[model samples]
Target: MLTANAAAALLDTEAEAADIRTYLATQERKTLLRFLTCGSVDDGKSTLIGRLLYDTKLIFEDQLSVLEQDSKKHGTTGGDIDLALLVDGLEAERQQGITIDVAYRFFSTPKRKFIVADTPGHEQYTRNMATGASTADLAVVLVDARQGVLEQTRRHSIIASLLGIRHIVLAVNKIDLVDFDQQAFERIIADYESFVSDLDFSSVVAIPISARHGDNVTSVSERTPWYAGPSLIGHLENVEIGAEDRARPFRFPVQYVNRPNLDFRGFAGTITSGSIAVGSEVMVAKSGRRTRVKRIVTYDGDLASASEGQAVTLLLEDEVEVSRGEMLVTPESRPNVADQFAANVVWFDEHPLLPGRMYLLRTETEEVSATVTHLKHRVNINNFAHEAAKSLDLNEVGVCNLSLQAPIVFDSFKENRSTGSFILIDRVTNATVGAGMILHPLRRAANIHWQAMDVTKASRAALKHQKPAVLWFTGLSGSGKSTIANLLEKKLHAAGRHTYILDGDNVRHGLNRDLGFTEEDRVENIRRVAEVARLMVDAGLIVLVSFISPFQAERRMARDLMGDGEFIEVFVDTPFEECARRDPKGLYARALKGELKNFTGVDSPYEIPENPDLHLRTLGRSLENMADELESWLRERGYC
Candidate 1:
């Protein structure tokens, strides 16, 4: 080398050139695209992503060397570099040769920067797929040329549509395996278009490509002369994902109340949609109180205005009451505020979703107790048909009526994704069991309100000599529950106690006539009957409910509806064999012959009470004796 000064100058020049190159690269990646690749297992989704990364020169030299070595050692491409190995980073995935979790990759080209989500293909991981699609602006659904359209493909398409993904690309992968047949590609395209006609998508383009051979991915392939469409990478780079959110109304859900000092108080949250200025008039959705925005506080001092995707704190001119879970929106265009709404839900729990069970409904920054009041129908992914469904199992999509404990602000999922999506969490386990998109708020919820009356339940109960109570009888079918309840009601009636008996079969003829013997229907049947009994108890009556409430959870629900010490669970304990032998109405015989489906003691399950207030061994005890025991207990409790 020459002198040390000359060498230093040369090094500085190289450094400046590198910095200039980096700045130009960053400037080139001005536009950002978030998309997801989804398809069935072995559909070459990861391979397509790998091909994009490799062909664009995004892979490092040393990483490529290691990949070449790994391909020689354990590649599935028969000694060629397995492109899937580039993205399947999990050990379990590499061992099983299947993607289990969503693998995210970031890469940029001359036109735009891309964040690609490679979602799993297994049906069990449908929740993971939903999570990935929830934030994606476009979806690239891959299909194997040999298999054409499959059930998993339809399922993913349905989910993508439900998630409001407007742009879709049907990548007919592995075209070379079929000798670059244009007819096969056309057939697949026709099948897909015909099936997807019902879905709501802005545009759907079908492109034939070979991800393994890097044909028609980043560059036009010479093999596919019939395919006039742009390559996959070219389409992704140029597709205009519209900025529709800018035109939508503003919505900001307050996540935290920021009180840095006594003088400074602000509501902090991310702007979900539209834009907000410092002097904009905002309304608290829940309270409907109007106020003016005073300041927009951020980490970089303060902002005069905040737009969608910006997280900032807002200070209001008026000291209006605000809390977490409250939403700030333009008063002129407020979202719907209601407790009852209809939503499309994807059930992800192993246990099927039954109506009337309480779950934690969590949205952006709010959580409320909610119940799936009714399941409208389940969507069949294979044919896009709606079928009657009482409950939703794992990986099933259904439209349901939800009842929330409190009103929340929301928009139709089609209008805004941030304010319209929510997840159901299991109350006991705190596990996410379902994902739902709000369709619309039910009109009845807003129209009807609980009218306050001078004559309350307490006043009605005080009018009667005894306290209002619900004596619920539960056991297997033909377990003498009805007979024992009738005798107890008569005994209480003779003792001048205001008692009314709500027998299961008698009430089924009128109130619960629409219900069937299915587990979901049974749960609803119990719910309706319990509400009626609660109303009767509020009318100052000692209600005796006799039903074969087989499920312990349902009995607990009824118990929870009553006041403390007001519900007395009477377990009519009779063995299944004993109940079947004593089937007076021939129900057990019909159920055994498969004529009566979902008949308890034959096919359906009956959960026994772990701890009942009164346990009567009906095998050895008479109905009159059991009634006397209940009457004695009531007398001791001063209810008679």
Candidate 2:
């Protein structure tokens, strides 16, 4: 009854649907690889990524047509088709003819799916490259054949290794410019291998190719007959990514406490390592509290088991003390639990890292106050040598010992990156200042414990019949901090009020004699004075700390050490010109003539208190009047 044409059309439609189903099934099973391109300025990082996308047939005809027009407008490639435009999508990057921000692209071959990051090549953009490298499994470190291995090449390689990128592809780009000479390629490879001998890359594969033109990129090139290595695409598709994370111990960082109802209290997080089943036992890595997983809950339903990278809500069979920022792991695989540790830090802030400054240490789910206790050494990128350094400047890498306010769960970066990595945030500005990777616990953190005392602060204050507080005096040099502090202490002593003055100059002569007047030393000076003042306050004495304390960061640190409402900031506001004119100790003259350094109001800066408890204008007020006013403030608040 049906015509031949109708029957043929129906059969063809059914065949097409079957083919589409098979293709989708195959695509879903393909493995994915994440990588990044990095090197020095104009080393073809972006161009290399663009070429990969193009040679893989990911670009469209319309895109190629517009690329021709953009090439003319940008003149980056002399009116030719600029393949780099495909990945360098930012208008600023195109205008400047360089990559600035990190650009990400996705493409796929029959064997694997790829996500590649095109990172900037300039030194200032090292942070951007680091951001890209943090998640990459492999790094395609491009090098110009003519220039050979450069400083940035070495720096990127070092960072890649530090970030745990085991596989490295050294794409010797612009090989055509070097006349496809095998000797030039071999020389660059020799230098790179020699430098990276100290690094921790599992494999280093060097290939010669011209990214601008399609030579040895997707297939073997006839020009490089001496080279026998696989093409870039071939090597990437065949590179074996280890399944180490799954084989290692299980680690689940509890992101949130999900208590949807009284009937269910589940711990929700993405399993960072290994696997967990419905009946598997997990222990609190820090506390060693054991519990069993009752159910592995997901949106799709309860899973019998879950592996690494899967987000699920785990219902425990027994009640346990678990909180956010804690890690649940295998019973036998307990992680390091300590408040003090050593780490490798990459400084990103323009403000140099002051050793004693308090910074916010932010891990995966925890944040605590931490300070760099010591700078062991800074690594010289050029020669991979260690050099002594007091502070870490921008783009500098150093190893430091850090002391945290509270202990948190962690593992060494080599074992588990998610739990082992952290970022240092400036407390005042909340700006991310540095990124650090934990090496190991300090061992002292475990041995030392706080000793309990029978005499408490409350008991001491009751015995003295007066409230203990810290009167923090801050001002420019010759601005009457010491003068006012000395007068206030005398008044308090006369009134039978126990008081002590930790004068800056006097303490430096004894407690801080080893410290210099450098910025780092100044921070340490304030830190030591703050600790002493805290102890004096604990002993029921009204502690008066007189220091310039020019930087706000240290002042805030000192203030944070005190109890709420117990720390009062007294600002002695003397005009800079007036303070310089007084020059009471002749120190200002020496400072102005370059004989002295780190002198507040001359070479160093003073950050005035924005909201001081007592603002005394020294331009007109006498010392006696100011001291009288200060004593009155204490009396009004019932301190004396």
Which candidate has the highest TM-score of all? Answer: 2
lDDT of 2 by residue, 1-640 (tens): 7799999998899999999999999988998899999999888988888789988999899998888888888747775689898877888999998999999999999999999999999988888888898889999999999999998999898888888889999999999998998999999999999999998899999999999987889999999999889999999999988576657789899999999799999999999888999999999877888999999999999999999899999999999999999889998878889999999898889999989999999998889999899999998998789999999998888899999989999989988877889999998889998988899999899999999999998899888879999999999889899999999999999888889999999998999999999999999999989889989888988999899999889988888888987799999999999999998999999999999998888888888888888899988779989999999999999888
Candidate 1: TM-score?
A: 0.88
The lDDT, on a scale of 0 to 1, for candidate 1 is 0.91
Clashing residue pairs in candidate 1, if any? none
User: What TM value does model 2 have?
Assistant: 0.96
Give the Å error, residue 569, model 1: 4.4
- For lDDT, the strongest prediction is 1
Over 4 Å off, model 1: 1-29, 65-74, 260-264, 350-359, 387-393, 426-431, 478-480, 483-496, 556-595, 608-640
